[model samples]
Target chain A: AQSVTQLDSQVPVFEEAPVELRCNYSSSVSVYLFWYVQYPNQGLQLLLKYLSGSTLVESINGFEAEFNKSQTSFHLRKPSVHISDTAEYFCAVTRGGADGLTFGKGTHLIIQP
Target chain B: NAGVTQTPKFRILKIGQSMTLQCTQDMNHNYMYWYRQDPGMGLKLIYYSVGAGITDKGEVPNGYNVSRSTTEDFPLRLELAAPSQTSVYFCASSYLESTGELFFGEGSRLTVL
Candidate 1:
């Protein structure tokens, strides 16, 4: 069984400020990690993913996450955020052959103007 | 691009009532999944299908049933609605396994009273 833990339930940051959402996972086997973002009244969209190779993965929108195997963490970070970045972010994990991803409790990113 | 589509964007069901949430994908992906999202609880997988005619249970499949009759359609049925089942349901698909990115539907919000 695999599990994901997102320590922050909510994170508030002013416009142009940097933000980091912490995520950690526990799995007996090698796992793939992903970050998904959901805007108000919309479905989730893939932000980025860490499947293999380089430890750092980035999304087109300027968000990036690093896969740290030693620490079992994949934390999302953005140097600066905008009002449009306010949304619920979820961290998920899956073993390569699993049926579905195991998601974290989610972290609501609240960006202030 | 009409990616994944989920019907009944919002529905209200009385206790003991039954309803089916429809999902369709135009991407021709071999893997489809159903997940429910609760506030502060992220998303929990209910069921998944590897391809047409093959289905399996996920983390939370007790109160729900699913059928994948074709590559494009995977419908989830709630036999007897309950307040505990009040949440937003999302349908997603991926060409490969979790190693690939997932495309999601806009989601269907269901409320049971």
Candidate 2:
């Protein structure tokens, strides 16, 4: 069985400040990692994914997540956040088959002006 | 493209009531999935289908039933609604089972009273 853990349930950061949302996973086999974002009253959208290429993956919206196999972690990071960046972020993992993604509890990123 | 569309954006059900949530995808993807999102919790997979008529249970499938009669349609049925089932449900589709990105619908909010 695979499971994901997000250390922070809520992260409050000032606008224009850097932020990191921590995520860790436990899986017996190799896995693909992903970060998803959900805004208020909306479905989740993929932020970035690490399939089999480089350990670091970036999203078009300036968010990036690094897959660290040794640490069993994939943490999402943003150099600077904006008011529009306020949303809930989730970390997910899936093995190399037809299995569905296992998601963490999620971290609410609240940007303060 | 509409990508994925879920009907009844918002619904309210009473105890012991039954209803079905309809989902369709315009992209003609072979893989479709159903997930539920609870407050402070990330999405949990309810059921998934590989193709028309090939459906399987996912992480959370206790109170739900699903049918995939066509490549584009996958509807989830709730036998008896309960307060625990009150959450936002999302329908998603992907081209591949493992590595492809998932396109999700706006989501259907269900409130059971």
Candidate 3:
């Protein structure tokens, strides 16, 4: 079985400030990691993913997550965040097979200007 | 594209009542999943279907049942409602199980009293 843990329950940052949301996972087999973002009243959307290859995967919206195998972490980071980036972020992991992902409790990003 | 569609955006049910949440995807995805989101919990996988006629349990599948009789439809059934069952349900589909992005529905909010 796979499990995900998000260390922060809520993070408040000023607009245009950098932020990092920590995520760690535990799995017996190889895993695929993903970051999903959910806006106020919308469903979750994929922000980025790490399957294989470069440990650093980036989303088009300037969000990036680095997969650290030794640390079992896939922390999401953004150099500069906007007010619109306020949302709930989730970290998920799967064993790279026909299985559903295990998700973290989520980190609520609150941007203040 | 309509993408993944989930019916009854909001529903209220009393304890011991039974109801079915309908889900459908028009993207011809072979993998479909049902997840529930609580207040602080990100999301928990309740059930998943690899394809038509093939369904499996996910991380949290105790109080829910699911059926996938066709390639486009996967309905989640709650035999008897409980207060714990009150949550936002999301239906998602993907072309690949672990390596692809998951397209999600708007979500179905269910309240049980």
Best candidate according to lDDT: 1
* lDDT, candidate 2, A78-113, per-residue tens: 999999999999998888455768889999999999
* lDDT tens digits, residue span B15-55, model 2: 99999999999998889999999887788999999999899
**Candidate 1: Cα lDDT at B11:** 100
Best of the two (1, 3) by lDDT: 1
Query: How far out, in Å, is residue B32 in model 3?
Result: 0.7
Lowest lDDT block of 10, candidate 2 chain B:
B94-103
Report the C-alpha displacement of residue A47, candidate 1, in angstroms. 0.5
- Residues B1-113 of candidate 1 have per-residue lDDT tens digits of 79999999999999999999999999889999999999999999999998999999998999899999899999999998999999999999998644647889999999999
Write one digit per residue (lDDT tens) for candidate 3, span A10-75: 999999999999999999989899999999889999999998999999999999999999999999
DockQ of each: 0.74, 0.69, 0.74
- The CA root-mean-square deviation of candidate 3, after full C-alpha superposition on the true structure, stands at 1.1
lDDT of 3: 0.93
Docking class of 2: medium
